[model samples]
Target: MKAIKSFSIGLIFFVVSSCGSLNPINPLSLLMGNSWALSSLMGKSLDLSQFADGVPSLNFLEGGKLAGFTGCNNLSGSFALEGSSIRLDPGAVTRKACPGTGEQDFLGALSKVGNLKIGKDKLTFLNGEEELMSFIPKED
Candidate 1:
């Protein structure tokens, strides 16, 4: 009887400690060579193409350097992972501004991103708790 109680307590402790492992992987780690689409803009979900020319791309190299497309133009930025939150810095990009509402909208969305989420097989950018963009892993 005492053995059963001890085993139960040990099982509970193991489960609790492992819970943090389920939090999810860093989004930047999953962003490598992945093309991410804007699922929700500002705070709503709409056809991303309704305001953009192409799906944004995310590429991570051997090092920590990061680069991607901003739908309108190409951008390169540095990123760091803290637990599960992926943080992006103000990146340098092509100065030739893209025309049309889509380009403008894409650029605007990038500005509002705070952190990112990486799931088992997808990635997302968050504005507070709301998801702004989500990306699926692409086949190389």
Candidate 2:
């Protein structure tokens, strides 16, 4: 009985120690601040700056709110974060037609995003397991 108790205690300690914690930045923190455009692609890298209308912009607010000019129309949407997964609620945009390959690409990429991964300097929007777009921080 004594040996069995010792083994159980050891096993418990090992199990507890082996488990890791999720230290992902609080989703609220991500939402409360601004995120800039780094790179974007649904299938290929598109010029992110062009979409900003010379604004160098990419920003997201709390509660999944997002906005930026894709060198065309302004885009915005509601987003949700669950653990490591993200869901972009159907986004809306201005109806004015944007002229340029960059605009078309930006529109395509935004429509496909289904998840998001935030890094210290980058936020990667993903569709399933593949990256759809990436955002970097701009100096204020």
Candidate 3:
């Protein structure tokens, strides 16, 4: 009878410990397969009407690929993430005669991104602790 009780306790403990081993949601899962639109840059809110090609946006793709628009030009790049650290490399940008300086500003900010913050509804790029750009979920 004592052996039966000990065996039962061991089985219960094993099941409880196994439940804790289940992985929690990964933060990277939040970024992948999501489209984010630029809402602010350098502490200033953007006026989407001012962009020639609508608001700038980013689509994080699988396998470390990135695709986006720079308000006037289409942007393609690669990104590497290690924990919260991020490196954004702007690869090719379509050369179109853009009116305002929004595209330039966007690219410049992208180059400066050294870290990232993912909030409940926002993605913010930062150079160290200073925010360089902020994005929101792109409307479907």
Q: Scored by CA lDDT, what does every candidate get?
A: 0.65, 0.67, 0.88
- What TM-score, over all chains together, does every model reach? 0.63, 0.66, 0.81
lDDT of 3: 0.88
For model 1, residues 63-105, the per-residue Cα lDDT tens digits are 6666777666777877776665666653787665565565566
Q: Write the per-residue lDDT of candidate 3 for residues 1-140, one digit (tens) a residue.
A: 99999999999999999999998655578787469999999989996655788899998888889899999989898999888899988798899988888888889999999999886588999999999999998889
Winner on TM-score (1 vs 3): 3
Q: In candidate 2, residue 81 scores what lDDT? A: 67
- Pick by lDDT: 1 or 3, better one: 3
- Tell me the lDDT of model 1 at 69: 70
Q: Rank the candidates by TM-score, best first.
A: 3, 2, 1
Decoy 3 TM-score against native = 0.81
Query: lDDT tens digits, residues 59-124, model 2?
Result: 767556766666666777776667767666437777776555676666666677777777667778
Winner by TM-score between candidate 2 and candidate 1: 2
Q: Superpose all Cα atoms of candidate 1 onto the true structure and report the RMSD in Å to 1 decimal.
A: 4.2
